[model samples]
Target chain A: MVRIQDLPRKNFLMPGNAACPGCPETMGLRYVGMALGENAVLVIPASCSSVIQGIYPRSGIGMPILNIVFAAAAAAASGLKAALEIRGLKDAQVVAWAGDGGTGDIGFQALSGAAERNEDIIYICVDNEAYMNTGIQRSSLTPYGAWTTTTWTGKKEHKKDVPLTLIAHRVPYVATASVGFPTDFIDKLRKASKIRGFKYIHLHAPCPVGWRFDPAKTAEVAKLAVQTGLWILYEYENGKFRISPLSRPYRDKSKRKPLVEYIRLQGRFRHLKKSDIAVLEKYVDEMWEFYTKLEEIYK
Target chain B: MEEDHLVLPLSRPAPGAMGKTGTWRNYKPVIDQGKCIKCLLCWLYCPEATIIRHEDNSVSVDYEYCKGCGICANECPVKAIEMVPEVQGGA
Candidate 1:
């Protein structure tokens, strides 16, 4: 029972790093690091995350980070795990942290290969919904109707369902988490660390700079994301779907915030029109309805 | 003196829209009518289309549709609108 207020105050990552203010990726990394503790080796890719950790000799995180190429994070982590097994040193947890671009786009092949092999490692994709490190370019995870450098008019396609993609692989554990829900995220990380086979954690990390939102509202924005049904918090364990109770439908419509509010808070979606917003709302409704049906069927 | 008015077209809400409805719990967008160029940017970008127009053509938030996401406040060009906390019901 990690009390939100009583969470350990020890700071593993130092300040003055490159991360923008109220960066969701930084928060997720911090909590995940805390959950895994010092007995972990992080395999990073060429994304905003790599910069957040800083360069060697002055890294932000306390653990040993193995910075790999843009698309080989999953493969590198698997290799490290195999090497550790060969050395008979299986005590430490090996984690591969990648951005949405690295995981959903360029790195998808390597990641799918690792999961298909059931490699023993934990993989977390800090999805800011776009390629933030390389200047707000659009990725497969960028939600439709949202603006980005690549999609100044708004992304025409819907966000790719990465969790369900992993579920197709039928891995041992796959969970969706957000820094907005720290306890839930930490719990998932802890559980993922202990699991033997491939585990996947998809975190919706808010990017203040890329999203063009205030730094202080990072957590608040993420909370609204889940509350609005734009981002669902759930897990699939051994082919069974366990939708987090936090994702319960908005029975009291009054209590449910509009998806527009969530969209407006971020600068990325500033240019959306009435028709665009309508399309996004419909997409959100359809996705939420689909997720609910999945929950009912699996329940 | 008449104020310079910027009338941003507000999207009319459809009947039977599904959204969180309360007395506008999370955000309360306060318009400083004095500074309002009446640009209506708040009305245009409202995700919920919660802004209501009076017969006199003044704009206000329809708490029924407002989710308090604060995009209106952020996009207000003249800083005429401020997002204050709703006195009741926010997570």
Candidate 2:
């Protein structure tokens, strides 16, 4: 069942290694890596992830991580899977753990190639919404009206729907997860790990640095990301789609918290006016409608 | 020899023997034992995994590699951890 309480005790990711304190990416990696267990190998691309794992030998992530270029994590993971299979290590999971820049922007081509081929690799994008490692630059995954080094005035475009794009690739397993909900995140990772063919797990990892929130509120931010419909938790497997437990109540617009409740929590969105909040609210409503229609059509 | 070193699968002479990283930290998290509820929040949120969760759920920082990012102090729900600026030469 992958209980949240059992996660910290598993110890896949060791302490006294490098990673910013209150970094949600590492927290996600710890939970996912523990759920995947000792048999898995991580393929990290150039991002905060590479930094989070530390500088090589002292890497905090307990699993063996194959660090690759910015846009080639999925490709390297595919190659690693082939090598391991040739060596007869078939059941082992080859995880492509990447940041938003790696998965949504620069690495999208290779990621699409892997998903199209249905490569037998478990791909997880731990999105913190910006290029946090190289300074908080705007990536395609950064949400609308959020500040970044490149988008000093706030990103004019909407956040890229990376997982939905993956689902369109018709991969066997596709899902969204949040680190705030450890049980849900663990359950999704465990489910994806057991399934074959290019499984996509999109984790909405919170970044205290880029998100401009108090480090202590990392969990609260992650939870509210779902409660406010800023990030939805759901899974699509074998053509069946289901909303996660914590996000189910939020399926209805009236039930969800106001978008301001989410925006006010982070400093990145502080520049936004009430009209901007209204824009995001409309965007959320459109997203909910889009998801509902997509589910119905697929169902 | 250069190529051999370059081709190494995972290049660390020793895992986590990454030298005294403690010297880099500008601040250190001091646990207020009296106020500590032993909740383990600091241990779980620590990126370095530098904090050790004891059998009794009480936690201790491993000074060997604790880079003092203040995640422990920041995450402690009971406000048990206080981040003190690191002073040179133990002063």
Identify the candidate with maximal TM-score.
2
Candidate 1 stretches greater than 4 Å from native: A251-255, B1-91
Error of 2 at A29 (Å): 1.8
* Deviation in Å, model 1, residue A54 alpha carbon: 2.4
- Residue A23's lDDT within candidate 1 is 59
lDDT against the true structure, per candidate, is 0.75, 0.82
Segments of candidate 2 deviating more than 4 angstroms: A8-10, B1-9, B12-43, B56-58, B63-91
Q: What DockQ does candidate 1 have relative to the true complex?
A: 0.01
Chain A TM-score relative to the true structure, per candidate = 0.95, 0.97
A111-175: candidate 1 lDDT, tens digit per residue: 99999999999999999898887788999999998788899888999999998899889899999
Compose the digit string of candidate 2's lDDT tens values, residues A1-299.
55434664656765545566567886787776667887889899998777755564455667877889998999999999999999999888999999999999999999999999999999999999999988999999999999999998889999999999998899999999987776787888888888889999999988988989877678778888899987988899988877767787888888898888889989999999888888899899898888878778777
Worst 10 residues of 1 chain A by lDDT: A9-18
Error of 1 at A196 (Å): 1.7
